[model samples]
Target: MDANRTLALFERLVEIESPSWHEAEMARACEAELQDLGFTVTFDGSAEQTGSDVGNLIAHRSGNADGAVAFSAHMDTVKPCAGICVMRVEDERGEVLCSGGDTILSADDKAGVTAIFEGIRSMLEAGGPLPDVWVILTTCEEQSLLGSGALKAADVPQGVDCFVLDADGAPGSVVCNAPCHHTMDVAICGKSAHAGVEPEAGVSAIQVAARAIADMQLGRLDGATTANVGVIEGGVATNIVADACSFQAECRSLFPERADEAKRQMTDAVTRACERAGAHADISWTLDYPEVACAEEDAIVRRAKRAIEACGLSFQAVRTGGGADANCLRGLGVNAITLGTGMANFHATTEYIKVQDLLDDARLVEALIAEYAGS
Candidate 1:
């Protein structure tokens, strides 16, 4: 595969305005590109549910028709800025870099998309091909994996082993473990009264929430678990006792038992705090995504290891609290693993991926395809 060509493709994708739930134009461009490569493409019914102008772009290329290997990536970026202007830069050492200072470069998943595209392109352009390659580019992944969440179980073709190229960190790092998260929103109700006149008559919801927050254990919990409250809102005026308060928080853990324990402890803490403050509090919790922990002996893991080995990179299994589309696939009972693209400073203005690493990722995907096909 041409490294420059792969980088050009990634740059072009980032330049398009494809934020969560608004990926019509980018999806169109990808459709044209895939069709040019002679892949059978379909616009899955995610646009209607997501209220976007387009749905997921699912492309297929069947060659060595035994079992299929699926490559997946999200086509959306996080909020703040879109319609990116990707600039290619070279430092004093002449290493290639790509970015735009004001907005995100969107290498998070765009790199993933480009790698899959390049892998397929390389396979097709060269003589012979691997097993059937199924590609899925999802939407609304930044908005909590909504597109993949709505995907029908039967729609994903059988014999399709899963590979989601949407993790960060180092290129050689393979994410064999990720966490499940629970988001909790709490609203506290209290009675308001004048501070100087009748301080005893009013109950302070802010005070109650404060007490609750202070009492709860937050930040990193153990090695694989963590809990934290990120958003809080309440209080109308300074003089009156704050009657209504609201808070939003989350708990995550790599182990299901640990995650479950964290959830139970958090809920119990919220209830106890509200009861102690003499104010009523409503707590709601939602599981953001399921956890994924593929054992070393699993076939998918073995395949990924062989692929990584074939790419000349050492593979290390690490557990992470960060969730990804892999969580969604794992939830559907599909064994999947998250692969890294060597992106740095993600979700920030300094987001960037080295051009060399980007090309290496593309090559890695190609290697994986060749390995799987040979197997």
Candidate 2:
């Protein structure tokens, strides 16, 4: 892979401000690049559902080999990235890319995108036998994987093993397991009265919510489970008893049963608190995305291990608490795993990626393609 070319592409991508739900410009740029590389590109009709300017970009190219493999990366970035300015600096370690101290570097998935593009370009330039390749650039990944969730099975090619290049770690880290996430919205309704005059006549919803939260076991339920109430809203004034209180919380667990049990416990806590306080509780739960676990013996894992080793790096399978496009793809019966792209401090202003790491990621992608081609 060409290091300079890869860095140039990375710079271009990160400089473009494509926050979640607004990836039209980035998609257009990627589409043009893919088309220039001789891949047929098409945009899906998921924008209306995802509320993005453009849909997912699906690019394909036929190769001389028999089998096919798919690669994916998201085109969206987190907030504070509207006017990104990438700066390349050299430290004792090596060359690193950073932002202008005002926003995130957006290397989380852009580095992945650059790697895939450079890898495919190198393969094509080599003019040798290569397996059929499908590249999917998704949108709204930062917002709970809205783009990938909207993808239909028909949009993906059949019998193609998929891989997502969006993990945050060294190039050789492979994510084999991720937790299932569920979000809960709770509303507590209580009678309102003047706090100083008729305090006994009012049932404080805030009190009910606080009691329920205190009774529940939050933050690290066990090795595989965790819960937290991140957002709360309600109350009118200090002199008046609160009439309604609402809170948004989430729970995650590697095991589905554990997550379900956590939800049940939380619901029970809310019910008990509301009953004791003479209030009514309204709760709703949503499954954000399912868990994904790939065995070491799986073909995708095996190929990825080989490819990582081929790039002169030790391969390590890891479990993550975050959700990615891989979770949705796995739920759709596609064998997929997430691989790191050497992004550090992602979703923050301190985000950065090493130049050598970018090159190594490209090499890993090329090696994976070679493995698929049986070269």
Candidate 3:
């Protein structure tokens, strides 16, 4: 791979401000890059549903081989990512790319995108017959996985496995399992009245929500299960009894049943709180994404292990508590796995990727494609 070209591409992507649900200009930039790489690029039209400015970008390149393999990474980043300036600094792993103290570096998955693109160029330069290569750059991946969830099964290629390059850690680390994520949104309805004039006739929705949250077992429930109340909003004034309160909470577990039980327990807690306060509680539960698991002997795992080793890195199959595009892809009935790209402090202003990690990731991508092509 051309390390300089990969670095330039990564810097260019970082320069673009592509917050979730606002990936129009980023999509166009990637589309033009794909065209330069001789790929047939198309839109999946998922923007109409996900409310993103652009749909997922699907790029394909016909190859001289029989089989096919896919690669994916999201084009969206979380907040505080605008007007990023990529800076090179020294880390233990050598030179690193990061933001310049004001905004996030947006390397959570842009490094993944760069690796995939550089891998294709390297494969072509190696002058071997290539397998059919497909790329899926999704939008709205940060906010509840709206982009990938909107993807239809037909949008992904059939009869092959896709490698999702959007995890944290070393380049060779593969997520063997990812948690099943669930969310709970609640609306607490209570009677409102004057605080001092008719206090007895009023119910405090904030107090109801507070009591519910207090009764719930949040934070880490176990080694695999975790829960949290993320958003809470209500109450009109200090002098008036609040009539309504809305809250958002979430939980995840590597085991599906455990995640379900966590959500259930939270719902029960909300019910108990509402009952005690004489308040009506409305709760909605969503299984955001299903778990991803692969056996050590699974063909996909074995192939990934070989590819990782081929790139002179130790292969590690691990579990993760976070949800990713791999989960949504699995829910779409496609086989997928998440691989790390050495992004550290993601979603924060300190986010960065080692320059060597970028090169290693590109090498890993090339090796994986080579393994699938049997060349």
Candidate 4:
């Protein structure tokens, strides 16, 4: 496979704007590219459900008669409107680096998408033996996995296996464990009264919220868990005792019980604070996505480790508190793991991926396919 060709494709994909629920043009581009690669592609109804102009793209490439293996990634980014202008560079050690400017280079998942595309291209060019390959490019992954959530598990091809190439850190690092997240909104309602004249008659919802927040345990809660109240808004005027306040919070943990425990604590704190202040508290919580924890010795994980090592990189399985498309693929009952594309500083303007690392990831993908075909 030509490294330059793959790098070019990665740059092109990152430059495209495909943020959250706005993935129309990017989805179309993926569809066109998949079709050009001689794959039969289908567009699901996730767009309408997700409020996007385009839906998820599912493509199938039939080769050897072996069971199908799918490679997946999301087609979106959390952004500052940065257009991909990838620059290829090498340091003294001859490591590949791909970057643009002050904006994000979008190696996050774009590199993953490009790698999968190039892998397919290489197989087609080589001709002869190859396993059945399926491609799933999802939308609205950044908006809490809405696209994957809307997708029907039964719609995925039969006898399907999957690899979601959308993670960070070293190339060999395979994320076998990730956390489930609970997104919540807490509202506190209290009776309003004149602050200067009848302060005692009024209950302060803001005070209730303050007490709850003070009592809540946020940030790091052991190595595998965390909780935080990110946004708070309440009250109308300072002169009057505020009658309403609300806060948005979330808890994430690798273990289901840990997340549930955190939510329970949050609920207790909010209820106690409200009751003490003679106010009503309303709590609404939603499990944004499920966790995925694959054993280190699992066959798929072992195969991926071997593939990475074959490509001249170290292989290791890891656990992460972050969620990804991998979690959603696992939800589909695919034995999947998240692979890094060397994306750095994700969800920030400084995000970048070494051009050489991008090439390495592409080679890693090829190695994975080759291993599967041989097996």
Query: Quick one: best lDDT, which candidate?
Result: 3
Candidate 1, superposed: residue stretches over 4 Å from native = 44-53, 78-94, 100-104, 127-129, 143-160, 190-204, 235-243, 348-350
Clashing residue pairs for model 4: 15-84, 96-355, 96-356, 97-354, 97-355, 97-356, 98-354, 98-355
Q: Write the per-residue lDDT of candidate 3 for residues 31-50, one digit (tens) a residue.
A: 99889889999999899999
lDDT of 2 by residue, 1-375 (tens): 998898899989888889998899999999999998889999999999999999999999988997788899999999899788888899875899999888999997899999999999998898878998999899999988999998877887655777799998799999998999899999999999999999999999999999999998899999989999999999999999998999999999988999999999999999999999999999999987789777899888888999899899889899998889988877666677899888999999989998889899999889888888873
lDDT of 4 at 204: 94
Better of 1 and 3 by lDDT: 3
Model 4: CA > 4 A from native: 14-22, 49-51, 78-83, 93-97, 100-102, 140-154, 157-159, 345-352, 373-375
Q: TM-scores across all candidates?
A: 0.84, 0.88, 0.86, 0.87
- Residues 1-375 of candidate 4 have per-residue lDDT tens digits of 688798678767877987887888888889899999888999888777888778888888886745457899988877764565666566653554445556666676788899899977886787757777889898888887888877767767644558888888778888888998889899899989999999999999999999999999999998999999999998888899999999999999999898999999999999999889899988999887789777867788888888898999998778887888777767666666788777888876656677667777778877777777764
What's the residue-level lDDT of 210 in candidate 1?
88
**How many residue pairs collide in each prediction?**
0, 0, 0, 8
How much RMSD separates candidate 1 from the native structure?
3.3
Candidate maximizing TM-score: 2
Q: Is 1 or 2 the stronger prediction by lDDT? A: 2
The Cα local distance difference test for each model comes to 0.81, 0.90, 0.91, 0.82
- Model 1 residue 135 CA deviation in Å: 1.6
lDDT of 4 at 239: 90
Tell me the lDDT of model 3 at 43: 93
